[model samples]
Each structure stands twice: as structure tokens, then as C-alpha cells.
Target chain A: MQLKKIKSLIEIMDEKNLTKIDYEDKDLKISLEKSNISELEEDNEDGWIISPTVGTYLDRDKPLKVGQKVKKNEVLFIINSMKVLNNIVAPRDGIIEEILVKENDMLEYNQKVMKLG
Target chain B: MIKKILVANRGEIAVRIIKTCKELNIKTVAIYSKCDKDSYHVFLADEAYCVGESNPSNSYLNADSIIQIATNTGCNAIHPGYGFLSEDYKFAKKVIENNLIFIGPSLDVMEKIYDKQKLKDVLKQINVPLIESYKLKEFIKSKDKNIYPILIKQVNGGGGRGIKIVSSPSELEQTIKELNKTLKEKFDINNYYVEKYIDVYRHIEVQVIADKYGNISILPERDCSIQRNFQKFIEETPSSINNKKLLDEIKQEALKIFQFLKYDNVGTAEFLVDSNFNYYFLEINARIQVEHTITEVVSDIDIVEEQINISDGNKNEKETFITPNYYALECRINAEDPNNNFISSSGKIDILNLPSGRNIRVDSYIYQGYSLKPFYDSLLMKVITYDKIRNRAINKMQSCLDEIIISGIKTNIDFNYEIINGKDFKKGNYKFKKY
Candidate 1:
């Protein structure tokens, strides 16, 4: 019934390698089918900025906003793990495509934090 | 104090380091190859990353990727375990360049020790016995059946690579060509030298430890003589040498090398002992070796913990010469079907039964339902036992091996059984034979 629920179902389908899913409830009935083709290849003439540790991730001072151009060696964010603050640096010069994480979000080891191109 | 550390190698050593880190309250980051996603080391770490693909050149050996992972994961230090980048000069330099702690010898010390010829020259000054290694070209061109029995060894080789024993001048040319071809194809290495092959020899290594403050300690020597094709399967400490005088001499020689080099952290200086009890230095392994477990049990010291503490600048505060209180033996079990000529047995581990109880420790990375990739070393577990005497230790080790059970994949457990329960092993007379 809700779009968020539908999106979550699609994610489960992807994880389970399922092509179709059916659901029926007191007030909702739905059947979704996924096409065989994989999604678009990510364009990152520059690759993604990935999280290096398991911790709550927070942006650097003056919060990094998406669509901003980043230079090589720039401090993008900080991952605080076991009481140590580690800076996540830009591997090379690139423009931020999207920030996949929010401030104070718990990030697993090596999670992609930003897409760069 | 290190809050988090990255383990850059895989297999039991990675798992071993993680256990120590957990004991010291240090967080650990594990890096694995794509094929090793299900590896025990990955599942044991506080956090894990897929560094690269299954091919070692792209993953475990990918120094840059490992460094990036360490920095990204907030690791303040890196433990290069043993093999992958343990003695790498450039990688150690890079780690120091990034201001992260490298838990081994400094690049300067490593370079000095890792240069085999230079190390020999340096140690010769201290009266350390060393076998003469001939120049490659001289060895190739010489008409020396006079030096008939000789070994062609790669300059930078380990784990049984680039080693061929030639008995006659007639076999020299063909063997060198074959070895060079394999070395080039696998390692892109082309350098090798000729050393007089000792037909009958014993492998003895001295375990040495040093702190940054120059305090060095030498532990009891270990007899790593029992091997198949140069790969050690059984290792024992308190070498069967009942003659205290000769054993003491061996330990002193090892200590002299350690002090002379100002070596730091844990390392073992290997030697080949001839029948007359004369010792000759083979090389120095500058990392936490796989057989370190036996030393731990015998000496009652946690080597990995000491490594971490020393990295944090601990001053070998408890430095002292160590004489093992108990005799210890280790059996290396691998996922290989020995019946089929040691072909790798890769697949799901369906059932598992591990040995426990007094005087026994089982170090392994496999679990029930764990599947293995065919692209790595075959060592699956180490069964170590300790007791008041060597005979008791050997018996305990055989029992431990008998108690281990894992189905759905063939293992060399029985091969280990023969060694531990065999007459030659009990007699402590097992020595390497020419192929």
C-alpha cells in the first residue's frame, strides 16, 4: 500500500535473487515482477568514496553538501571508531555525485559513502 | 595505545591476531580476497572488507589496496601477519609515511636483514656460521661436478619456491632452465644462486624478540626438521638434543645475530645443522611465523600480544632469557587428500569435531558449512600440545589429531597422524630427504 514498502520489497527481491514477488493482506494485494536486465552501470570515471571503519559517520566542519567539487586529499568526512576520529580523504580530484549517508548514521566497514565522477 | 589495527594477511594467522587483539581490547579490521569472503578471519574481525579478487596479485598482495583499507577503516596500526607484506620494504615505508604504526622491524632494519647476502656478510663478523652462496653466473658457468651435490635457491624465495637440488653437473643446466621458467611465470623473479647441498641436515630456528628500546630476548630453539618437499608439517620445541652444551651454543648464536642486527619484535633466524652439530645460518624470517604457536605454549608467552604491546612502545619491560618449562609439538593439518598426492580438497565443511581439554590447543579457521576457494594455501589448522617432557608432548599431540573430525572435504589429518604417531618422529630423528 505504501511506496516505501514497495521499495523495500524490491530490495528483498534483489537480495533473494527473485524475479517476482506476491503479497496479499487484509487491505492490500500486489504482485511485482523484475526485468532480467541488471541496473545501469554506475558512472564514476572516478569511483566511490567508501567508509573505512565501523562507526558513526559525520561530515567534516561546514557539512559537505552533494554536487560540490572536491579536490584531491580533501577531508570528506570522519568515522569515529573506538574513540578515535579518522578522516576520510578524497582519493583523487572529483565532483561528488551523491552522498549515500546522513550525519550520525552508523556505517558498516567499507560502506560506500559517496559516488564521485 | 592502539585502538584499532588492520590485519593484512589471511588464514589462521589473521584469526590468531584477531584473538590477541580481542584479548587486549584493541579493535581489528580484516581484509580478505573476494574468494575468501567466507573465510574465518573475515567472520572473526570487528569489521571486514573485500580488498580485491581471488588472485593474490590483486588481493592479499595488493599493498596499496590494503593500506587504503587500513586508513579508511580508522585503523591506527597494521599487523602484516607473516607472509604477504611482512618483510616488504616499500609497504613498511608507506605505512610509516602515512604515520600509521607498522608492527614489525623498521624499514632500515628490514632492508639490512632481508638482503640475504648482506645479512650473511654482516653476521659473519659476529662469527655466525653461514653457508656460502655462489653468484648465479659463476654457478651456471662453472664445470663443478666437484661441487656435484648443490642446491639452486632463489634469492628472494620462501614457502618452497625457487629451490632445486642438483646432484651432478649434468643436471645443472636443465634444472636451472626449468626453475627460471617457473620463477618467471609465477613470481617474475629470475635470480638464483648455488649453495652446497647438505645431504643430511636438521632445521633449527631460534625465536628472538626485541623491543624498540634495544632490549633483546632469545627463546629456546625449535627443531623444524620434519618436512615434506621442504614444507614443514611437524614442529617441536626443546629439540631432542639432551646435550645441554650444544643446545646452549645454538641459542647463543641466534642471540648474537639478533643483537647484532638490533632486530625488533618477533622473528626467527633459521639454520641448517649438519650431522657434526655444526650450525649454518639459512635466513631470517622477519614476521610472526606460523609455528610461533609452539613457542607460545612452551614458553608461556603470547607473542602476538607482545607484538601489539611493543608497537605501542612498550619497553620489553619483562625482558629475560626464556627456557621453556614444557616441551611442545605442533602438527599442521591441511585441506588436502594425501591419498591423491596432496590434491587440494575444496568445498563445504559439512561436519566438524574439534579437540579440546588439557595441554591441547587447536588453531583453525574452518567451520561447519564453510566453503573454501581453490586459490590459496592449504593449511587448515594447527594442533599443538604441551607437556612436562617431549615424549608426553608427542603423545598428547597424536591424541589431539585423532580427536579432530571434519567431513565433506578431505584433509591431511591422517598424514599428520602418521608423523605424530610414527617411530621416526618419536625418536626425534626425522630429517629432510632428497627427492
Candidate 2:
């Protein structure tokens, strides 16, 4: 059988969402197997507070400083997105190692705003 | 005059718009999601900014972030390129509310065109032939057996989602119940209508450009009949309909509709032509389409530039008649496994070679080492070929496809090559192929 025919058979299997297919005809016999693609990502192990949405970055009323100890769920910063202010809270109890962003800076989603140590 | 534009889109369309802005001496601002930060569109723009996460809702479709970026950058206009917010009436209204020019149709025109039912009603007023449709209650009451294979569709649906076909009377009620569930879950809306489904038909669309003034110019009709899952895979200009009279009629009806509505910017009127050559008006797309490249290749016109000009209130010279100079065809090369049910194939592009030369054009955003993200559409690039004859155009496209190579992931390039060389395509007898 031609390679094209086998390729097409694989397409039929995928379109049918089947993992395997077998075919037998008067003069032709074919079997195909398909392996699904695995989707996985490594977790971010380092301590980083990423912005959740695109907005204007602003400091809280009590400005957070480097080396400051923060409790989990404490409001660390504020992001004014589309006129709605979103509180960027600390994910866990840690000391701030670095302040990556400044006041009134435009921040993008997943951008590193600060680092915890 | 529009000085700067914020392209509220990504991928090839965003790159396509920014290229035109460069030619027209207009600055551009591109917004990218977190994953797209390293993409080509970001580097092509005069200024780029990160918007949100990789997901569309928090990124490309985040109208507020897009508008804020445009305003903060001092851009005079916002070009919602094709997908995200291009036909969004609410976003267009918000752009105007923020004192920025929305580079497409006006808010009122978009409002009517976005609603498929309303657009059909307006077409009916102008005597355009329309497929019979029924409201939910009326369809249930008048479940005529004649129209057995009826199509159920969302009133405000796109991307070919939540559409179902009932082939027999026994399957009608059950199909409706299942379709309603899908619609509610996918679109979060219970509103839907039933229409007579034409089993076999050709998809033909007319491209029109209109300014704020009543001046309208109609281009050649495009045959987008080759499709899979309702998404167009191949498109060509100067449809092989063989009946000049029928083609002319389709173009005339399209002109009349646009002239009546006084539509602004560039838009396309789609139609479904049956075996008898009887054409039924489909809804109009209020923005540029993915296949606009083929039309541009044949007509030698920059549609994006025209869009910007119209948005700037520059009047177009009234030209009622325009003809194509060549035959053009476009094949979309998607980063998907055609041998695996077209599932998106995403990975880093280790090796890449794109075709070039005369009568051939490529519009793409992929490059060497570019990682194909699963969070976006699978369209990798578009390869277009044009010649004075259709046969030559097909031949050129075949060679173009052969010259291309993309490794590290699967692509539909081989499939597209087979399609262009298929007997049905060679004889110009291809219709909407069921995949």
C-alpha cells in the first residue's frame, strides 16, 4: 500500500477519535495505532508574585517594601484593570526579596511584580 | 487623518495590519499575551505591550485592556483585526466612547450586521432571496415534515459553534433538545432559530468597500466552497461557477445591499448557491476575512489601506465596475495533524523554510524556533498564488507547497498539496466537501 493511504487511514482514526483501527479488504489489509499527545508543564517553583491581569500597577496605601514580611492573603499591591481594582495578595507567608515593578507602571498578566524569599 | 493605530489582534492578521500601517506611514501599537511576547507580530509593530495571560478572555478579548493601551499610547485609532473584537458592536461603541476611531464599520451598522437574524430581515426588505427560518415556538408548532433536515443555529453565533442538523422527523425533537443543551453550555444563551438546511451548496461571497459617504465599490466574488467543520480551508477568486449571468446577479444583489445600508469600511456578503444556481443570502461579515489575500492578489489592491482610508473619512472614487486581472488561490497551512483528525500540533519549529518568488505571496507569523502554542488557532500560514490562468495558478501553488518545509510539528501542507492536485479541483467541479 502507498504511504499516502496509510497516512489517510491515520487521519480517519483521529477523526473518529479512535486509538487504533484495523481494515481488511479483498486485497488489502492495514492496521494503525495512534498515541495521544501529552500536555504537561513544569510548575514555577521559585517564589514569584505574577500579575493576574493587564492593568495599571499601583502600590497599596501602606506601601510594601523589600525584605518586609507578608502574611498569606495579605494585600501586597493593587492592579486597576478596566476601572476595577484587583488586590494582588501574597500567596504564602514570606519575606519580599525584590520589588520588580514600580508605582503606576503598566503591568501585563503573569508579569513578575515581586519575588518572595 | 488617522496617524496611529493599535492593532487589537495577534498572529498573522496582526502582522498583516502592521505591515500596511508601515506602508501608510502610520505608527502601530501591538498587544501580546504572555506566551506571544516572543512572537513575530510583537517585533514588527512600532511599539508593543503585554496585555494579559495566554487565554483569550484575559488577553485578546479583553477590550478594556486593549482600549486602555490605545489611549495611553496616544494612538488615534484602533484596528480590531478580524477575530477578537472586529465585529463586536459593544467594543466599537466603547472605542468611540473613549474618543478613538474604530477602524471599521460604524457602531450602528455593526449592531445590525452582528445579529444574523436582523441582517436577514434587512436583506428581506430589499427583496434578497433568503432561506426559510422559524422561531423556536413557531418551529415546534409548525414542524412540517417537508423540511425534514432543518439546521438549528444560535441567533448570535460564530466560529461554527452550537449548530446541529436534524435529518428526520423522528430525530427532530431529540436533536433540538440536544442542540439547546450544547448552545446553553457553549454560548450561555437559550436563543436559537431553525432554518431549512440546503444539503449541497457552494459558498460564494462578494467583497465590498464603502466609505462614510454613500460611495460603494464591489470587487470580484470569491468561492470558499472547500471547507471542513465549517471552517474554510481553501479559497479562490473568479469562481468557477461557469454562469456569468448568475455570478453577475450575485454581485449586483450584494452591491444593492451595501448601497442600501451605506456600510462603512470593507465587508463581505456571503451566499449559498444550490445545484440549480439559486442563491440564498447568508449573513455579511463586517470585517476583513482571512481569505482577503486572494482577492487582493487578483485585484492588486491593498484592502487594509482602504479600510484605514475609509475610517479616516476619505471618500473613495465611485467605481461601480471592477474586474480581476488574474486568477488567484489561497491555501491555509495549519499547524495540525491532518493524519490525526486535524488536532492542533504544537511544538517549537526547529526547521522552517517558506516559499517566495513572483506571483506567490505568503502571510504568516511563524519563524524558526517559534513555539506553537495550543491556546491559539491552528492556522500557521497562508500561501497564495496567482497567474493569468487558473491552471497555471494551481501549478504554481503545487510547486509552492513543495518548496515549503516546517519541522518539529505536523502541518497540513501535504494535505493542501493533494487538494490542489485533486481531480475535482482540477476540473473546477469542487463543492463543499464533507470532512
Candidate 3:
């Protein structure tokens, strides 16, 4: 059973692009943790990066019509966290492919507030 | 009688002050740095404003910005909780000038006690026992006969910043040079003094509450002998000193100092007692101490409330006095590596399991998914335990520590366990220097 658990961790690491996994069974626990160097680098190249700040979603509030061109660093929405209003900017100069959050909605940190293509 | 108060700080202390204000039915306004936008205190306060950038010099320490916030918010008072501008006499003066009560001592009183050397002079005038030594130049002149193994301390410093030990005359010059550089760079004070180093001495402090009506009361002494890097890590009450006479004498002296200072509000007088039972007055903390919970646990007096009331010109209820009833212990759980020079570690808290039971209390602002910031003190939580007996209190504290589960961030929990189990601590035969 221990060998099988270790084999499964290795498979999960490759399948999901995950670096670490903590598992526990009764008193016997194991942590297959990887270094943080690769994880930080992986954030630069992403398919759909979520907004790291909390605020209201602008794109979702007013759905972008088809073929809307969004410039790089153009604020797509604002996430207000009761303290500061964060301007969620586009990751790259791309088209607004989709919107994920609604207006006047509470946003969580690092949640997918919007999607930019 | 403060209708509104502006907290001139951020993070847990701000939240703590806000909670006290809420209990007193006082509206609270919090001023936060740009980086602390999502701080819990900002959400908990009735109103909040952005002061400036994340750096302390620009935000929390900016007296002008804080005064402006308080004036704009229409706050009648401002509470500078402990750090930043808490001890700044100029800031306190500014608050008073703006017709806002600074929830601390008057500017004149603060100025009198802010400098360590000046405070020592005051204690000396009152016949407080102080270690003997001379200035650096005097010691350098009389090196052979005057100078011995002594502690080199900065004249205007606290929190163990510019301090060193010189064992012999040969190393005196170099040590002084280094300490001078560090003192000038850190505290901007080039003055230095030397004192006889008291080895194997227990650090004990008495918490005193003095009102404007000239009534002073001493709330039992706390033994903070367990320390790391000259900073207190664990504090306990009913210090295994069973000598009733000695305890009474120390309490009387502490009260005498408070009376002499004409101090109005809460303060702590620290002392170092050697193996021979000879106690020497170290210094006075003119503000709320970190280990105040130990006293509160035994005394059953809400010190924060008392300070607020006293500042508002309300008299303390004479019947509501503090007398030590049982033993209490407080362990400061810091986010630092015990094995490595106590270096701080910052990360998100993945899991939190605080212990709760009879007479066990945990004061913290941390929750699951909360990130430990690297720009502040490493203290993550303060766990206090109380019992009828000292040994039982220690045992309960150990059990509580064992039950606490903190992941993602490495804490000094393991070191705390080692300290509670160590022979010197178990026997109550420890000193602050051991840390």
C-alpha cells in the first residue's frame, strides 16, 4: 500500500503539473514536496491567469461585444476589497474572449475574476 | 469618555485597540498603509483611510498624516498602539495640539523617560538599585582598575538594539567602536555607557496602574527570564520566588517609582535579580507591555480598558483592584527558526488548530490562508495558561502548545516545547541571558 501511494504521487505530479502533495493516513503521513523555483516561473506562461486582487468585475458588468480589442495593461475591471480599489489589467494585448465574474459581486483573492485571450 | 478614536497603527494591535473601543462604545477609525488595504483591522473599524505607502516612515510613522486622518474623521482621541509613533513625544504633542487625546502619557512625561540614561538618573535619585559603571571615555581612561567584564549599552535605546559584552580590556576598544557605529546608524545616538554585567539573573517586572487622582496600584510581578536574543519569549507570574518579604519590598519600590514619576496610566517597571537576591532596577516601559496578559490572567483586570478610562479622566473603581490569585504563563509564538539565529519565515497559514480549554487563552490575528508578512515583528500569537499552581500552569501551557497546529509557516513551537521541558525552566532556575 505504501509503494502504491508513492507511485500515485509520482503519477499525479506529471499529470496535473503539480509539484507537491501532502497525504495522511492515520498517524502515517508523507509529503512529496518540490522546490518553489519552478512554480514561480510557471506563472509567466499561462493560458488563463486570474486576477490576484479583489474588486468589482467590469467586463462581466457590461459584457464586451464580440470582436472587442483589449490593450495590454488596460484595466478590464475594478476589484474593491473595502480598503483599496484594485484595477485588474489585461495580462497581454489581446481580445476579450470571455468574462467570468459578475458586477457588484464580492471577489476573492486570486479567484478567476476574468479571462483574457 | 471618548466619542470617537483614530488608531494610528495597523495589523493586530490596531484590531485590538478597535475591539476595546467597541466595548467602550467608542466609534473607531483606522488608518492603514497602502500595502495593508486588506488588513482585518481596516474591515473591523467603523471607518478607515489610506495614509500612504507600505513603508512605516511614510504611513504609520507619519505624524502629520495620522493627525490629518484623525481631524478629518472627527475623532476625539488617537491611540498609538505600542510601535511606530507610540513612543514619539512629538507625535503625542501633535495629537494634543490638535485637541485630540493621545491615549498615553503626556509629552513632557514621555520626554522625561524616553532616554534610557535620563530614566536611570531618575531611578537613581529615588535610590533605586542600579548596576555601577561609567561612560566609555572614563572607562577607557581607568581601564585597568575600573573596567571589568561589563555590558556595553546605548544611552538612548531599548529592545536590545545596540548592546554588547566585553570580557577584557583588550577587546574593549573594538567592541565600543562597533557598538558606536551600530548605535549611530540604528538609534542615531552615539553616546554609550557600561554597567556591571549581572550573570544568571532573573528578569522580573511589575505592572502598575496610576491614575490622575494620584492612586497607584501594583499588579503582581511577572518573571520573564525565558528569552531569546535578549527579547522575552515566555513570561510567567507568581515567579517561583516564595519570599513574601522580598516580593512585598519589590512591589513597594515599584509603587514608589510610579508615585515619583507622577505617572498617569499603565506602565511596567523592570528589574534584574541576581542569585544573591540583590535586585536592580533596569528600566521602565512607559507603555503597554507585550506580556501584559500574564498579569491580566492573575489580576482579572482589563488593563486596556483601565488605560482608556484613566485617559478620559474617569476614576478607577477603588473596589475593582487587582490582587494576584493564581499562577499564569504566557508563551510568545513567533514565526522564526529556533535553530537558526531566530530568522523570520513568511508564508500562508495552511491550517490552524488553536487549543481551547479551561484557563487556556490564545490571542492572535492569524487565520487559515493568512500570509505572515516579512516587514513586521515575527510574533504570530500569544498563548497564555492559568492554574492554581505554577507547575500545573506550566503543564497546561505545554499541553496547549502541543495541541496547536500551524502549517505552511515554520514557527518556534518546537523551541517553546524544548523550553518548557528544559530542566532550568522546569526548576524555575533560569535567566534571560540563556536565550
Candidate 4:
């Protein structure tokens, strides 16, 4: 396998909660394992968060207002670069646990754009 | 003037040659591999035909198929642009045997210069200084006193393949063995030669054009010292050399060598000039070079047209054309990452924003949906900038590169910026080895 593809696979393994992955091709052979991490706990008090493309996190503009309700897959914030633009979305159906980003905020790829319980 | 021509290659160079043919009012035919069904060259040509599969061995290098297509298309001539079968003497002979113009030097001339060792020996007889080499036994006997860091290069190779450096006597055998294995695998030849490696040598080449009736012209020299892995990254005309006499001597020696071989058509004579002003003959590229655009920009001459004119039986006088008021530089943008060993990256070009401005010329066939092929050279585009002064030319090139953008595949853009902004390059004090 190409070295770049291998590095990308490692990144994917680290990001997701998967036990193992294997791929084979005429010119490539790959096997990957993920480190043990806590399974995401579902909580009614928690909100859903979605990732755009994979990257790092930036700063937020403002804090969450108390008692605000947020729906699942709702637009939370935006992450961007000179060439790419990605929007963070609510992950699950829940109330806003805590608003993460401000009005004009920066974020990383796969970095928690918002806190989803 | 030639009435019709066929381009026996594909991709950017073929498209480039077609553009010039259009300007000269010469009808053009293009040949493509199956993988290049939607290539820009096909769209640009008056007519195009598929030769074979994407693999170059069955397609572009299939001289017989290409000749047959040319014959069927009623093309009177064929132009092999810089790669594939461009320098294949047998291909040239086959084309000529079909009673069509080859648009390059005769096959006999190509045979004399195809062998690197033989070419070096010939240049040596013509008084062109070259790095001295000893046989394997002689090298072993003189290891203690010989140069400390010389290159063990495959005798029949070019393009930096099958080359290794032997820094000390202890590493000589190991390096030679590895290099021999590589040469055998890549070129099917085991012969190699050793030469004194000049660390701070500048890569300079003279562009010469010859007609059928013995007329030749030496265009201005180009400094291609900014290179990586022996492949040129940046090239500029009006080299930083200040010694007029020495430059003239080098050009004269190159002309003498060309005359000795009776080489006709467009060719480049390369040299490695060291810090002490000593120049060593490198090799001759029988086909047009990748950086030929820089020479064309500085000299204001269409090299493709010149080749066609020569092939059409036009006779001209021997003369040296100098760059009048402007300097030009070219950057070869490839689909490779500098930080990752320059490995070829293949994917669809989702977005491609080519840089443009006054004095900027971008020669590329990439489009928004173009797929970067995995089977061919990784060169993606040639970005060139020109100005009246050297620094201006450099700045223009930097700005142009800044505006350029590509997605879905990695490139060497960052490395190009670093090289241009580096202090050594800014002062023009760097050599080809610095890359």
C-alpha cells in the first residue's frame, strides 16, 4: 500500500471506535488495530455533535445560553481552510448540553465542534 | 513548410506541439492510448486515433501502430515530443522507412549518441572535458588516492536512475553491487562507470538547432541547477555565469561535438560547471527537453516550428541567438509530495486554478475532472514567468505559484516556494546538488 494511504488509515482507526480492519490487494496488504477507548455514553442531558471532514479544532466565539434546546444533526459550527469548508452538525436527538462554538469560530477536523453527551 | 503532421505522443507535450502546429497552419493528427480517450490532445487535433491500451509499451511505444495510423491519416510527418518513443532510433527508422518525415535527426545520428559511455569518449576526443572514470579493477587499485565522493553511475542510463554515491573505499563495492542490480533491473544492462562528483556544480545546457543542410544555431544557455533527484525543478535562461570567454568556449566545444556526430534537428548539450569554472560534458538529449519553454521564452523562437522547418528541407546558417532584454524561469509542477519522497499521487483533479499574469505562461493539460495517470511521468504542468530582470522574473514566478492551486492530489508547491525564497537561490549561489 502507498505510505500516504497507510497514514490515512491509521488516522481513521484512531478516530473511530473499531476493533480491527483488514484490506488486501494485488499490490497492497494492510491490517490495523484501534486502542481501547471508552464507548460514547448516551445521556438525555447531552447534545448531539457531527464532524465535517477530519482535522483539528479551533476556538469558539461565544458560550451556550442556558435552557436552549438543540435538535439532532443541526448546524453547530463551521470549520474551514483556504480550500475546504465543513460544517459541524448535532450528533443525536437531545437538548443543548453546552454550546461549543461562537458566532465566528474555528475548528479542527473531527475535533468536538460541540459537546454531545 | 510542412503541410501536415502527426504527434506520436500524448498529454501536455503533445497538446503543446499541436498548439504550435495550429499557429503554423499545419494540419495535425494526434494518437492516444485507451486511458487517454478524453485527453486534451485528442480534442485539439484535427483528428485522433486510438493506438492501444494505456500501458505505454503497447500504445505510445508501438511505433508500427503509430506509423500505420499516420499513414492512414495521410500525415506526411510525425513529431515525437520528449518522451515515450521520441529518442527510439528504431522508431525513427521505421517512420522514415514508411516514407514519412521523422521530424528529428536521422536514426544514424541517434545511434551514435544513445550510448552514454560511447558519447563521452567521442566528446573527449573533441576536447570536451568530462569527469574521468576508471575500470572496476583500476578503481579498486586507485581507491585510496582517488576522489573521496564520486558517483558510480550506470553507463547506459539517464534520468538519475541506477546512480549511487561512493564516499569512501569501504562503501565502493557495496554501492557498485546495489547500483548494478538496479541497472540490470531497470535497463537490462550491468555496465557502469565511476566519475568524480563535483558537489557545487551548476547544471547548464546549450540548446542547438540544426537543419537538413548542415545549418546550426546555438540558442542562449539555461541554468537548471535547481533540481531534485537529478530531475530539474526550476530552470532559467541567461545563466549566472559571468565569464564570457568560458561560456563561449563551452558553447564552441558543444558545437564541435554536434558537428562531429553530424547531429541534426533540435537537441540539447548539457554540462556540469564547477566552482572553479571547469565544465564537464554531461550528455546530449536527442529529443526536446522539458524546460525547452524557458529557452523559447528568452529567445522568442518557436523550437517546434524550427524543427518542422528543418524537416521540410529548410537550410539556415550557423548563429548564436542571445536573449535580448528579458530573463525567464520555469517550474515543473508534478503530482508528487516533496515531504513524502516525491511519490506519485493519483486522483481526480477536483479543482485546478492555474496562475496567470503578464509575462506568465502555463503549459498544462489538467482540467477540473482530469485524472492523474499512474503509468506515466508525474509532471503536471510547466509554469513559466518572464521579465526584464532576473529578480523580477523570480518574483513573478513566486507570485504566479502563489496564485496556483490544486486539490485531490498532493504537489510540491511548498518545496518550490522554499527553493525560490531560500537565501542561496536568491543570491544565485546554489548548485544542482543542493536540491
Using Cα atoms, each model's DockQ against the true complex is: 0.05, 0.40, 0.03, 0.01
CA RMSD of each candidate after superposition: 10.5, 10.6, 11.4, 17.5
lDDT of 2 at B376: 87
Ranking by lDDT: 2, 1, 3, 4
Q: Which model is ahead, 1 or 3, in terms of TM-score?
A: 1
Candidate 2 lDDT, B99-137, residue by residue in tens? 999999988788878778767887788899998887655
Give every prediction's interface RMSD: 7.3, 1.6, 10.1, 22.1
Per-residue lDDT over A1-117 for candidate 3, one digit per residue giving the tens place of the 0 to 100 score: 789888888799778877789888885589897775554343234435464533344443455643578776776777554335667666567766656666665443345544455
Across residues A4-116, which tens digit of lDDT does each residue of candidate 1 receive? 78888889998987889997777667899988543222222347766654566888997888789988788888987644788987766778888999887766545678887
What are the per-residue Cα lDDT tens digits for candidate 1 across B1-435? 899999999989999999999998999999888678888999999999877678887778877677767877789999998777888878898888877999988776888876666677788788777787775676666665376688877666665554777887768867766755766666432356677877556788889888988888888888888777778888889787546787788888888888788888888888888887777889898888889999999888999998888888888865557988899989899898989988889988889999998999989888889887788888888999999988988887778877888998999888778766878778876665422
Ranking of predictions according to DockQ: 2, 1, 3, 4
Say which candidate scores most in DockQ. 2
Candidate 3 residue spans exceeding 4 A from truth: A1-117, B133-145, B179-191, B319-321
Flag clash pairs in model 2: none
Error of 4 at B107 (Å): 2.5
Score candidate 1 by lDDT. 0.81
Model 2 chain A poorest 10 in a row by lDDT: A36-45
lDDT of 2 at B125: 87
